[model samples]
Target: MADDYLVRIGKLIRDARQHRGWTQTQLAEALATSQSAVNRIERGNQNISLEMIARIGEALDSEIVSLGYSGPMHLRVVGGRRLSGSIDVKTSKNACVALLCASLLNKGRTVLRRVARIEEVYRLLEVLNSIGVRTRWINDGMDLEIAPPAHLDMEAIDADAARRTRSIIMFLGPLLHRLRQFKLPYAGGCDLGTRTIEPHMIALRRFGLDITATEGLYHAQVDRSIAPDRPIVLTERGDTVTENALLAAARHDGVTVIRNASSNYMVQDLCFFLEALGVRVDGIGTTTLTVHGVPAIDVDVDYSPSEDPVEAMSLLAAAVVTESELTIRRVPIEFL
Candidate 1:
């Protein structure tokens, strides 16, 4: 446990140094130590004293260590303690998934700011890693950095990790742009009844993908010649479905129109991300989106997804149920 903390703190120091555009030698000078000593500290090869940790935090202007307060998970006194202060909503899991899949579209490095440290994100990272994409959590684990492999090792995919979330469906759109043939396990996650994936198939087929589901797997084949010459109308306005279409359209090299689309928070965040990738998207907040696809995307982009509306709603529901006064910040009122 002590070693783990030391490694995490070391990562925090390295991230802070990079953020400030400082070299190891520069940081070593600031710390009045040799570059080799600083390197050892950053690599977690040397144990650091608390005084040195505090000095490093001060030098980097970061709170590398945190003391979290634990609270009861269950109600024992009928919510006797009234909540009064405001709390900010964290980043969205949906956006994080969308952005992770979208990162495959870029050949350069992708940096995401303040991404949420959720199980879903961790699973997605596992899948990405299994397929040869290099990823790391840095900047006190608030940021994520990803670099795509020259060629993906599809056979090495982490099937267990990929099956943990239904967000795996979003991979269809982006992967279509990268591979001509690939197989994915049946989409899994929270069992919210028998929700059909027919809509996803319908949207992706417009971009020349043919998917066949049989015996717990989806065998996907792509026809490189297929492109949407006209507007593609989605059968459903589901957020992941819309994001799938957007991911496909992003690298299509022509204008693709999507109707009956989702204007949800995650989809909007995806649109902004597509724009950052140099794809033009119109109607970001509405049900119709016109995406002018580019032939290629190779930019080292940095993007920050919006706050979670569902989280805000959860806080509001807790406050109302407990009859306690609380404030939720960054609610993304448009979602309401």
Candidate 2:
């Protein structure tokens, strides 16, 4: 519905451009779109991205969206900044969510070191607290401590928070151990194509996890008696799917080696945390992972995940864009 309305506005923009006797190339140059894109919008064909809409509006010297409905733009420049100060890398968000979900495996307290104080973590923490996980911030919200939750308070879940992140799907891996059946809100992340939860369900099905998507949430049921008869191979080399598989395997009482695993940055961080919890993870930096899941795992572990290369790139980009030089230390070049 919203898309239809937006496309209608594209036509209006095209018509306006035409009324001014502008060629498709001329209009494209004005709107910063390629001639093909301008042609598509004029024909009511192309589905526009938000970035396109902004550029078009800027080119047309007209406002596609109403004036009152916009957030202020923000940009910061360090001005060729080279840092002499030593800055410690913050924990990875990917690892933190996986660790938080895995914490349910333990009946004791879980303390995470230097957790990122970003919006995404706060959303997961909200969902955790709603599910009866006792999480608190120490050292001014830098250090996070979460106590084992008796069970997830399913009804109290923050739907908005859960829906705002793709990591919410990871909860399924840990939740299956604690509940026979539960539902998780559908994932939300980059505005990319529809990513199926089937990979997660398929990998976990070996562990007796049965999930069905309805409306907008993933409905799941776990048959504790069912364990994988052999190795689990992921359908795609996705990062989150691998984490879900690891979290499930972490509590499975046997030697489970995950084949075709994604040795991504987040996965490595999770492996580090799992190792700290006494779970043996072989092939830490490779596609194949041999996980020796311990039946009983109770340990106070504080593991620091390295910095995000994406954020570091963004900082470096800010420098390059403004003709500045910036030194980003502790960049996990492995991920880069």
Candidate 3:
């Protein structure tokens, strides 16, 4: 049993080395050991000590064996501690997910500045990666650099990742422009309780998309000849639904008007991104939007989405709740 464990660990080390395109001799030099010693370790013949195991993990940049940790995070609070100064507001999860899905519209690279690193974003990234979208966090995870492949592999979509976030439904808008037909697993998140997907369906159907939800999957079929012949009035002004409409409209060639649209923070961010892709949007921060959609967009764009208004308001609420006099910077007051 011990010999079997050694063999598995050796294979892991060897696989990591090859994945990095590192030669056995190069790994030996990094560890200050001969190639023969590295060979013995790879073959599970070397008696590796704990210190050497730690060294090997450090060189390979992975945890071969972890003690692991599990606990709920706690905040240490001292009573009556006065709070002062200001903190910059972070990005929005809504905006980040919208931006990530909208990246499919551009043929060139898309670099988003100061995106929030949240669970929603990570879930969307997993879905993107599974479908061949290459995304990386640069600038200490403050920014995201996304580069799409020549084509997305829809068959390999990550169903588990897709089901983790309701934001996955927003992908329908951009994807309708890419493929004729595809299936996405049902969206599940936050226990929001039978939130009507009808509004999204009604809005997207105007852009030639027909979606049917059955047996734990949504089958989407696109009619390429069909485009929004008239204004698309959303049934609800929900942020995610509005984003879905905006995404579908981004790749449409003619004028598309959306009424009863959301004037929330995330919708504004999506409009700004569409503009960067050369799509002209007439109304932002309003209930009505007139979008002049270009037939095709292939621009290498860089956009910095605005800060989170909800988080900013939370900071203000914190001051009132705790009776603390605090200053908050970079608040998007218009949204508030």
Q: lDDT tens string, model 2, 161-183?
A: 88766788888877777789987
**What digit string (tens of lDDT, one per residue) describes model 1 on residues 7-58?**
8778888866654445789888989999999888888878998889888877
Q: Write the per-residue lDDT of candidate 3 for residues 1-336, one digit (tens) a residue.
A: 349877877887776565333578988999999999998888887778878888987886656667656878888976665577778899777788899989988888999999888898898999999999999989887889999988899999987778768888889998999899998877652221245577888899898899776545788999988888888999988999999999999889899999999998789999999999999998998999999988788878999888888888898888787789787877886744
- Candidate 1: Cα lDDT at 82: 67
lDDT of each model, Cα atoms only? 0.85, 0.76, 0.84
**Model 2: lDDT of residue 121:** 84
Clashing pairs in 1: none
**Lowest summed lDDT over 10 consecutive residues: which window, candidate 2?**
188-197
- Model 3 clash tally? 0
TM-score of each predicted structure versus truth = 0.71, 0.70, 0.72
**Sort by TM-score, best first: what order?**
3, 1, 2
Q: What RMSD does each model have against the real structure? A: 15.4, 11.3, 11.8
Model 3 — TM-score against the truth? Answer: 0.72
Between candidates 1 and 2, the lDDT winner:
1
Best by lDDT: 1
